[model samples]
Target: MTRIIQLSDPHIVPEGTLCYGVVDTGKALQQAVATINRNLPLWGKVDMVIVTGDITDFGTAEEYARFRSIMADLALPVRVVPGNHDLRENMRTAFQDQDWMPESGGINWSAEFSDFGLICLDTLVEGHHHGELQPDALAFLSDTLKNLGSKPVVVGMHHPPFNTGIIPMDINNLRDSAELSKIIESHPAEVRLVCGHVHRSVTRSFGKAIGLIAPGTSHTVTIDQRVENPHTLSLEPGAFMMHEWRDDGIVSHIIAGNYSDERHPFTTPV
Candidate 1:
C-alpha cells in the first residue's frame, strides 16, 4: 500500500502577510507541517507527496524562501507542478534539488510508482486564473496512458477540470475542461483525477473516473451550499487529503487541520 499526501494552494508570500486579508497562510502551513511531522508517517515512509501548486502567492524569491523555511525538516520525496500563481523559473530556482518537481516546458510529465502511474499535467496559462491544458498536455496524456497499458493511473494538476457549481468562480476561471475530460472518459477504468484550487474537499464523477478536488492547507474558500457568488474565503480550518492505496481500491480522506479529539482508552481498578 502506498500512502500519499496532497498539500495544495499554500500561496506563501514573501512578506508573511496573509495572501488575502483573512488568513495567515504561512502560519497555517507551518502548523500543518508540524502536524504531519508529529503524526503522519509520510515524514518517514510515505511513497510520495505531491503538491498540486499555487506554492507562492506572488511567485517571488522571498516567497519561496518562506515556503522552504516552513517545510525545512520534511524529508519526503516530494513532487510539485505549476499553478496559476506560480512562476516556472522561480520554482525551478527554489526547488532545483527536487528533481521530481517538473521543470519549465516539461509541464506535462509522468512518473511511475510501485503499483500505479502518475501523470502531472500543467494547467496554468502565462498570466491568468482561468486555466487550460494545452494541446501538448493532451498529447502527453494520451501517450503516457498508452505506455502504461493497464496500471491504475492518477492525474495530478492544479486546476479541477470541471467547475463545481461555483458560478462566480467558475465564470471567471477553470477553462478547457472537456479537453482532458474526454480523455479520462475514454480511458475505461484506468484513471482518476486529483486537483486543487477550490480550497475545499469535493468529489465528482466523470465517466469512468472519479475527480477529487482537495482542500487547501492554508485556508478554505467558503462553500456556499447555495452555490451563489463564490468569491469569499472563510476562517475554516486548514486542511489536506491523504490518498490510501490498497490492494483492492484507492480511498481519500479529507483531513482538516486539527488533532484528533478521539481519546485513547485507559482503564484501572479505581
Candidate 2:
C-alpha cells in the first residue's frame, strides 16, 4: 500500500510575521507538524508528502525559507506545485533539488511510486487570484496521461476544477476547466483529482474521476451558502488529507485537529 499526506494552503510567512495581520500561520503550521509526527506511529508509513499550493501567504524568498525550516522536521520526501499566491521562479529555485521539477516552463511534473502515478499540473496565474490551464499546461497534461495510460493516477493542482459554492473562492477557481474534464473523461483508468485553494473540504465529480478539495492547514473559509461574498475566514481547526492507494482502489481520509471525547488517548489499552 502507498500512502500520501496532502497539506494545502499552509500560508507560512517569514519569522515573526503573520497572515493578514491576524492569522499566526507559522504557529498553525507548527501545531500541524506536531500532530502529524504524533500520529505517525498509528499511520505506520507514508510514502511521500505533497503540498497542493499556497505554500506561503506571499510568494517571498523569506517566506519560502521559513516554509522549508518548518517542513524540515517531517523527515520525508516532499513535493509541491505552484498556487495563485506563489511565484514560479521563487518556487522553482526554492525546490531546485527536486529533479522531477522542470528547470523551465510551468511547474507540471509526474512521478511514479509503486503502481500509482502522481501527476501535478501547474494552475498558477501570477499576480492574479484566478487560475487557468493554458495551452502549454493542457498539452503537458494530455501527454502525461497518455504516457501513463491504464495506471491509476492522482492529479494534483492548486485550484479546484468545479465550483465550490463559496462565491469568493469560486470566482477564483480554475478557468477553462472543461478542457481538463475532457481529458480526464478520455482517460481509461480511474483517476482521482486532489486539489487545494478552497481552504475547506469539498467533493465533486470531474468526468469519470472524483475531485477532492483538501482543507487548509492554517485556517478555513466560512461556508455561507447564502452570502454573496464568502471572503470571511474562520478560526476553525486546521486539517489535512491522507490518500491511501491500495490494489483495490484509492481511499481519502480528511484528518482534522478536532476529535471527540472517545478519541482521547488512555494510559491503558481498553
Tell me, by lDDT, which candidate is best: 2
lDDT of 1 by residue, 1-270 (tens): 667888999989765477786678888888777777777533346677788889888888899888888777666666777788988788888887775555556466678877678888888776788778888888899888878877788888998867777765565455767767777766645577889988888898866788898889877777665655647887778888887677766777787765664656697757
lDDT of each structure? 0.78, 0.88
lDDT of 1 at 209: 82
Q: How many clashes (backbone atoms < 3 Å, residues ≥3 apart in a chain or on different chains) does model 1 have?
A: 0
Q: Which 10 consecutive residues of model 1 have the lowest summed lDDT? A: 38-47
Q: What residue pairs clash in candidate 2, if any at all?
A: none
Per-prediction TM-score, please?
Answer: 0.89, 0.93
Write out the backbone clash pairs for model 1. Answer: none
Measured by TM-score, the strongest candidate is: 2
Error of 2 at 190 (Å): 0.8
